[model samples]
Each structure stands twice: as C-alpha cells, then as structure tokens.
Target: MRTVIHKLFFVWDFDKEEKWLCDMAAKGFTLVSVGFCRYEFEKCDPGEYGVRLQLLNHRLHHPESQHYLSFLEETGAEHVGSFLSWIYLRKRTSEGAFELFSDFESRIKHLNRIILMVISIVAANLYIGIFNILMCFFYHNEANYLGFINLAIGLIGSVGIWKLLRKRKKLKNDKQIFE
Candidate 1:
C-alpha cells in the first residue's frame, strides 16, 4: 500500500524535513515521490532503508546534476524524487551506512549550494516586492498588499539565509580545526 502525506517545511527546515522522512521510513513507509508540500510513500520493511536529502547545485535535468545523480545511483543510493534542486535518495540499510557527504569539505559545499539557493530566492522576492510597491503607486492599492506579501516572504527567506550562513561558517571552522 501507498501513503500520501502533506506537510510544510520552510527552506531552513530541511534538516527537520529529512528527519521526518527518515522517521517515516523507519515506520515502513519509504518515499516514492515528492511535490510542493506533498510526499508519496510506498510500503517497505521497517528500518529497511535510510534516506538522505540534498540540494543540488543545478536543476535535476541539467547534465551536471544527471551525472551526479548517476554517480550516486552507482553507489547504491536510489534517487527517489526531487523538487526544484532538492533530491531525495534512499539506500538499503543492509548496504552498511548510507551517507552522501563523507567529509567536511563535501558537507560544506552542500551547505554553500543551499545558501546560494536561499540567497537567490531572497533577492528575487525583495526585487519583486520593491517593483510591485512602486507600480502600486501608479496603479491601485490592491497591488500594494501583494508587495507587502512579497516583502514578508523575503524577510522570512532572509532569516533562512542567516541560519544557513551560520551553519556554513561552523562547518568551515570545523574543517579548519580537524584538517
């Protein structure tokens, strides 16, 4: 049997989302597909697979991304689904340990990708907000509300940017200390 779930997790909450997916896998539900705020899972043995989520540096269909995913698949991790630049992978527990990043440098690089994505979104949202507000002055009041909503979303993304930056900084510091 398959199960469908709807959950909301902000960009900054990716770690939390990963945890939830893993928890579900532990409960015999393994992810099969993903969409905006939607997850579809199929039945599996409890604790049969380990899940890992990554924010890729390019779109899923990009050659670079396809090659990277192919490399991962060769390593025994199955690409289950993706949304935007994010991908979900699963490896059987019997394959020993399943980890996408084995070193600090790779982990830091992953964080950088996520930070870049969030920053881009924040910049776009801020630009849209400003443009909408300016256009509202020449048009109608209703559009001003859209501007405010965009600004609010940008503000939220700014918070995520801060958090991701801190995380990247910490990873860099750790790499320096251990290396």
Candidate 2:
C-alpha cells in the first residue's frame, strides 16, 4: 500500500528530484511525505497526480508561508509536505500541468536564489576544510582523520558550487528564449 525510498540529492538538483517524483506518480506511487532524504509514497492510480516543488525561504510558521499555501490550495494544489525551505505540492493531472512560476523572469530569480544558497554552503565547507587541515598539520595526532573528512566535505561542496554556477550561466544564456 505504501513504499519508502531513501535517496540523497544536492539542493541545487531540484529539477532532477521533481522529475523523479513525477516519474513515480506516473507509476501509481503518489508521494505522501518526505523526511530528510527519505520519501514516503502511497500507491494510487497511475497518472492520477503531478508533483510540483516550490521554494519558500520563510519559516513553516510564518504568516507569508500560510498565505502562500492557501493560495496554492486555491489553485487546486494539495500541500503534501515540506523539508526545510522546500514545499512539496501535488495536483490532479486531469487539471492540467502544474507550474509554480509561469514567467521566465520568475524562473531566473528562483535559480539565482538557489545558486546563492549553494554558494553559502560551499563557503562554509571550504572554511571548515581549511581549518581542519591547518589543525592537523600543527597537532599531528590521530585526530588527522577529521581532516580527511573535512577535505571530502569540501570537495563535495565544491562540486555542488561548480554545478550551480554552470546551471546559472546556462539559464542566463537561455533567458532570451524564455522571453
């Protein structure tokens, strides 16, 4: 009746995540909730629903969030769940395709926001990695293992940063097409 999936994806890869959710919906698995990197899906009629993702920087309890959720509900989108700043919504496929941002400018702005968030995370990881490396060099103890962990974190963050920057550049170049 219900299935759970564990997966991890960078925040900037939201498009991929949305596509995966849509694929699941097309296979009769409707998403019920999301916890961290876990997804809970309930079996339903195939092609019955379409999933959409919305990014809201506001806290869950914020009045702006409540108002936005209300507006989405009015538009026939059901609020399934939220993780951090991401809101998961679903709507009946028969109602037509669900798109949160209809204009090119809005899409660009959304991508810019995501890019900035990724940059901040990358910076934090880089700082921690440098600090750990310096400590390991000065202390020269068994705690050096932490330096390797930090290095890995930094590398992962750098990859995310590179991907986000490339994505932003591509979006900017393709902006004219959207216009």
Per-candidate TM-scores read 0.92, 0.91
In model 1, the number of clashes is 0
Clashes of each: 0, 0
Once model 2 is optimally superposed onto the true structure by TM-score, how far is the C-alpha of residue 48 displaced, in angstroms?
0.9
The C-alpha local distance difference test score for the whole of candidate 1 amounts to 0.90
Report clash pairs, candidate 1.
none
How would you encode candidate 1's per-residue C-alpha lDDT over 1-179 as one tens digit per residue?
Answer: 87999999987888899989999999999999999999999999999999999998888999999999999999999999999889999999999788898888999888888888888889999999988998888776564688888888999999999988888888888898885
Q: State model 2's lDDT.
A: 0.85
- What is the lDDT of every predicted structure here? 0.90, 0.85
lDDT of each residue in 8-117, candidate 2, tens digit only? 97787899999999999999999999989999999989999999887786877799999989989999999999998888999998999888887767887888788787
> lDDT, candidate 1, residue 150?
88
Clashes of 2: 0
Best candidate, lDDT = 1
